[model samples]
Target: MTLLTIFSQSGKYLLLSIFAFLLISCSESSPPALTTTADSIYFGGTIITLNDAQPSAEAVAIKDGKIIAVGRYADIEKSHKSAETRLIDLHGKTLIPGFIDGHSHFSEVGAQTVLANLLPPPDGSVKNIADLQKTMRDFIATSPIVKKHGVAIGMNYDDSQLAEHRHPTRHDLDAISTELPIMVSHQSGHFGALNSKALEKVGITADSIAPDGGVIRREADGKTPNGVLEENAFFGVVYKMFPAFTPDEIAAQLQASEKIYLANGFTTIQDGKTTKDNLKLLMAMSEAGTLKADVVSYPDIVTFGDDPLLQSPLMSRHYKNHLRMGGVKLTLDGSPQGKTGWFTVPYFKVPEGQPETYAGYPAFSDEKLNEWILLAYKNNWQVLGHCSGDAAVEQFINAVRNAQKIYPGTNHRPVIIHGHFIRADQVPAIKELGIFVSAFPLHTFNWGDWHRESVVGPERAENISPTGWFLTQDVPFSIHSDAPVIFPDSMKLIGTAVNRTTRSGYVLGAEHRLEPLAALKAMTLSAAYQHFEEATKGSIEVGKLADFVVLAENPLTKTRANLKQIRVLETIKEGKSVYRSTEDEK
Candidate 1:
């Protein structure tokens, strides 16, 4: 046959073979070529996997975004190394499973950046009257936006502390523009200040009763609204004034926060609270391949409690790549420090209120809280309830207990997040209920002093956020920074956990000091395990996700203080170098 005829015959056979192979492989085990093969081998560094048996390693092999080999360099070479394999020598740097920040606000952090640039608050430290005057000036500059409905008002007032030390009163905001409405949120998000015009816009007056899960501040005479909105009450004001950002704008912001997260060494993050709009934005970004950070978004269920998505369909699943839709996050109570949370006992220090006998409020009734937990547990959703104070903790525990009674043998990993100011007595109950905890231990270090003087008295402050209590009780718990609120740099978390020092450099709880390895585990495998992804990632092990970080120093061998100084050299995701400090993006 001629060369042309021979080529034609060969092509026909190749086509037939391709069709046959596709059919056979679709019904059988993975094909040899399709099965991952390594392109790179990391052959140096102290690899810490958080797996107890093999806590450290000398090498790892990456192929198809998964680790095919993990062991000593010689061992990995025997099973996985190739002749043309790209080699990375870590030069004795520390390597561990990439940091997993269990709670963060990447979307909101971006929003905060934008708002801060567009609006400036008066320097709060400059005496009370001066600060108010500064606020008035800033409000005028932003008041022009009132031309657009729901003008952006109250972007700068901190409601926690003031001469009156309350939410910026409508009376004060009236000085800005009564003709145009305005609403400002508290830095804590627990409260909000509305201008007189905005209050009328929302139809909230002194006679307007507080909603079931919300509160409205009123003057002592109960004759007029004080302009402060709390919990669910503030939602209307925020949503009314909330400006919608475009998809591209949201993508840009998400990317920026992703960079911040990755730079600080967090490979994964869970948005503890998100809105439907935020969820839509994430969906848009994921479809466009713009979402770089691994996120498990759990939006607020309480706001939309009647939605079937929250009850029967407890945990929603997303395509497994980067962004995921986690279980719904509900804040049962407000911050303990803010004194808005529901507690069994009254707050240590009550703000200006009608009665001493009144315990702080809860958004959901006990019956409703129980109903929500039961429905979530029944649907097998992970309930990450934001409960910080002892009273809120107890309410959460009771709700969980009631859920168990209603539906037995439900292995729900209901997490009592924050665990702030929890007493030792609460642990046994929390453990008995089989709830997981993700403690914010850094608060013990970062805000311990402020917590000492104001929230919980200094004498009792040492008892706040005790990680050791959970440890001693064998609780299945993880620790995290409520990032944006506090950045989740693993080193800072470690420094805080091991030192138990406040931001002011005062050591608060010496007894609560955890080992360095313990802190690393919390940020890695422990966090991964919390999300039930331990089998796939969270460790430098054979047959797991090829996700690990190359560091400039070994945190394990270095001095305790050096843990804070350790730096990430490179970040690898799915065997690909996704980010590098010195090199250009490939």
Candidate 2:
């Protein structure tokens, strides 16, 4: 063969060898392609992603409880085209991220189901003391659940709404049951009333001194505790009164409570004030695989002081089987509506027993609060503080500032709960302190009229919650129901945030009203962020959990007045329907 012919043959072999080497390298080094098949594809609904990058989508593809793709319906349909994929038609509904309750008492909300509901208007029609007594009597007569137990309990009784315009005392509760120990919890859960029998049964007598940060209201003699217990005092006694529920009983209550939350579109809910017993119960429920929605609890820091459980590495944000112990919960003060919240100014209509100069007292002193804050900081624990009054807000701000100075980190994400009376001046400080505010906007509607006229005076009451102030300050804030204080009604909550209207139809803090989308964020992405589960749970983004709520209408397009009217058609958790409304579309 000629030289040219030999060279051509060599080139062919060399090229072939190079091609073979390239193929081998590609096969060995490249990552395997991700599975494109999806378990479900939701379409034909207006999807509010709550994701800034892609705020709206027509379709979402989910697989193994995660969002795999979100885009136009045609695009998702074309890519995941297959017969096995379950297609969900929204039926002209609107879908948004599953709500995350910023702060609430999950267990308490469930307990309300079994307890006599003494709530005033809207939730229950307890017009006066007589109505409350009658309700309790009726429950006692009818409920086998309560009748089976030795003691009797009723919940969510609000004095402010009573026609008598006062708290139900032992005399009132005695009307329900003097034979069996009877107790009625104030709507705020910061105060409660016990009958003479209950007071005696619990060993609280005239000789018993009030515990620190609590009060046992006295009679004219200044010796008799007239059945009223405030703050720590009430909690201490009531906790002991709780019957030992079996694990199954506890699980059943949890499921019942979660149903309410799920109906309102919450994927993650919180128990804002948990005790040691509650912690154990929650852990048991978690271990038993009974919790349906994600639950994050915050045990009372004062009660759990220096406990090994609080100090455990396990307590630092552990989520398993949809249950987590987020951190410690502290009460700087009590509830404003209950007139026990520490405030800078005196209440407009002070109770009969209180001095005109009496401002509600703090649950802990500045030094004690500082110590607790330091403990949380040192242990790298998130703190959720209940601070409804301005004074309490100030104390919280100082404690947080001091804590950060000692151990600084922007990622602490410590939260201020309630903030019902958060002052305009304090708004900037909250922003500067880098803390999150979970305001009780539901207070605006449930008790706004009463607050303006009775609790805090019109001027201060108008500014209650102050969501818009947080917005202007560019601080992270979200709206909450403080459930059992009010229902975990997300539509009602967002509507109240947007409307700031009271039950009496008065526009309160109109300036403080949030925009529709902003209100939605408070319940969705913003709330998830407060709980430190934003990345995994909040918003309808790819790779996030397939958790969403199907609404009858898009909140953004609806009129402000109609926001609350937008019903939750269905609540989807991990692409499975957890709640579906039985009522016809309104």
Query: Among these predicted structures, which one has the highest TM-score?
Result: 2
- What are the per-residue Cα lDDT tens digits for candidate 2 across 1-586? 8656766877878978999999999998998755588899999979999999999999999988899999998888877758899999888899999999998999888777777888887889898999988888888888876666777788888888888777889988887778988888888888989999999988999999998899999888999988999998998898767656666676677778999999899988999877666678788877787677888888888878889987654475647877778888898889888888899999998877679988899988899999999988888789999998999999999999999888865457889998889888888888888899998888888889889988889988889888888888799988888888889899998998999888889999988899999998888888888988888878999989999999999999999998998889898888888899999774
Error (Å) of candidate 2 at residue 581 is 2.3
lDDT of 1 at 283: 71
Predicted structure 1: lDDT: 0.71
Which candidate has the highest lDDT of all? 2
After aligning candidate 2 to the native by TM-score, how far in Å is the CA of 209 from where it should be?
A: 0.8
Candidate 1 runs further than 4 Å off = 1-37, 117-150, 153-166, 172-182, 306-319, 557-562, 582-586
TM-score of 1: 0.83
Q: Which pairs, if any, clash in model 1?
A: 65-574, 162-165, 343-391, 344-391, 445-501, 445-502
